[model samples]
Target: MDSDELSEKQNRGVAARIREELARRRVSRQYLADLAKISLSTLEKALSGHRPFTLATTIRLEEALAMRLRVSETLDNVAAISNGHADEQFGAYSRASVAWIEGLYLTVRPSFGDRQAIFAYCTEIHWNEAASNLRFNEKDRLDAAFTQQGTVSIPNLSGHIYLSTNTSGQQRLIIVSRPSITGEMYGILTTLQAGRGAQLTPVAAPIVLIPMKALADAPLGRINPDQPGFDAYAAYLKRTVEEPFAMFLPGVAAP
Candidate 1:
């Protein structure tokens, strides 16, 4: 086949696979478009064969669906689109360089509703062969449905790491200092606070990601003051403020 014909065939194959995923997942095209951060019109045109899918759009769709759409030439190349190096989108880190971070973490942060309670969960960070970047997923949550999974950004200039989730354009961010000698990361988490039915307010709190191995006996999920491990978990969280990992500025009130 000619180059143009081959490209056209690939586009049609991608469109078909995307349609299959949409149907299998029972998700709407509008939802997919929104999650992929693409305009509905653009998605519709590409899926309907009115326009070809651009590489950027295809990558976005793959990320949204958490699946590969392109048929690579070889399995090795297919394993990493960047040949084991993450693209600029994820700080261009290589898989080998970030190998040390591939492990489970006990993620701790303050409860949005309870001032004295600390919320604890499991966050697994590992390399994604398909995307060639470190990805993180949250588990062991009291509310599993709201658990997040997204790419990890390790920028060298700032000497900080970021765990961010972007769902339908709403973003949640956790900016943390690099791992200490004990592999603990202290930082600040900014996310939407769910209020009474459909109400969400912006909220920020100190957050910590401790290597699960370091606290194998620690408890998970809603560590209240009455809980056994609450003191230890609270201590780890306090370091976020005491060590001054992040600062919250209270703006000047009206005089």
Candidate 2:
């Protein structure tokens, strides 16, 4: 085919992949647009075949989805490199072995901004074929701009699951126990808390992950004390401490 025809075909392929991902993840187009830092109209036009996706827009979408849409000659080699590194780092667990953990969870934690409120969001865990490991992404967050996506590590020896994000040198971590009989995971989350005047403070808080399927028609986002499910959500977060899923140590003077 001619160059224009090849480009058009490629655009159609990328658009199809994007649509598939949106359906698979059950994410709204507006959410994807926000995550990709693109205007909704632009994404709509591109998806509708009225406008071709620019290289920059395609890259942004790929990063937002944490998956590749465009085919590259070196794609296999890149996947092999990622798989090799991830296998060693994430305990080499095969997709079948960790299949049970691949689903949506209602992630709950103490709100950083409100002492008496709980922040709720949706988290999706799925196997990354290219990376040969499990991956996770947080969505439906009130603070959507700060949403996180990262690799999941499940080490057999520790018997704990870790969701960690590393950008540049900064890192955010969540360590949770294995799923309970009811499919709830309790844990602690460690990340930088934004303070006044561009200041950031190191902070950690208890967190809980409940299977989305278990919470039928429950509200997400921020749950305050007066909210309907606040009490239950608070109880789940408290499990991270009461069950002793994680411990907090006070600082001691150097010896």
Candidate 3:
């Protein structure tokens, strides 16, 4: 079937399951509407099958119901390197391609002013072996883990940890440590300022994985972006990303 038809079918499935769960528990729709932080009318429409679920909305619904609506198999499949692609160029395919980052980390970045550490947030990482991907469920699962006391738990909100090879044959891992995207402005500021944007161009800094003991340690408090530890961490990450054969080596660390 086409994309639209598939989406509609998924929506119907989600709506049916949500309604069934609610009915089984004998709870009011308003209870979940409030939990999901969506309006009554909006929740009504979604529950009544008038709207399709976006990824963001699906996450919110998962949080509200304490269950994954429908974990698609597509989310876990990694595209194979094209046939005849040089192993040196594409890197060897392995079940361990993205498993080393499986743990908790406090993602940090420097802000424009004072170079103060922006405590982007604590993100938990895990391997989605089925999908051959890294799972970072910082925003959804960790916060809700302790809440509701008895809510049902699912595997995780797993998605692909994007990676691509550059012309130099270096592998770059793109990480979105922030829960929300920030930093965008339009013409008035950009036109007046030297380094600002004249038109809307949104950009957010991403976390680059470097082999840091602290990243694995996940110290109790927020990480300082300017600290020597973080400095070494960032440097190691950038340097490694530029290396030609670092990751493919056996027994090497993951980022």
Best by lDDT: 2
Greater-lDDT candidate between 1 and 3: 1
**Candidate 3: how many backbone clashes?**
2
* Segments in model 1 whose C-alpha atoms lie over 4 Å from true places: 1-76
Q: Which candidate, 2 or 3, would have the higher TM-score against the true structure?
A: 2
Clash counts per candidate, in order, are: 0, 0, 2
lDDT by residue for model 2 (1-255), tens? 333322676687788878877776677899899878899999999899988888878878877776666755335443555543457678777677789999999999999999999999999998765445788988788997788887899988999999988654478999999999999999899999998999999989999999999999878888999998899998887778877888876678534
lDDT of 2: 0.83
Candidate 3 lDDT, 65-157, residue by residue in tens: 545465353442223422212133223334354344445445433332234443333445443322233333332222232112111011224
Local distance difference test values of all predictions, in order: 0.81, 0.83, 0.41
Of 1 and 3, the candidate ranking higher by TM-score: 1
Each prediction's TM-score versus the true structure: 0.74, 0.73, 0.33
Error of 3 at 77 (Å): 12
Minimal lDDT window, size 10, model 3: 184-193
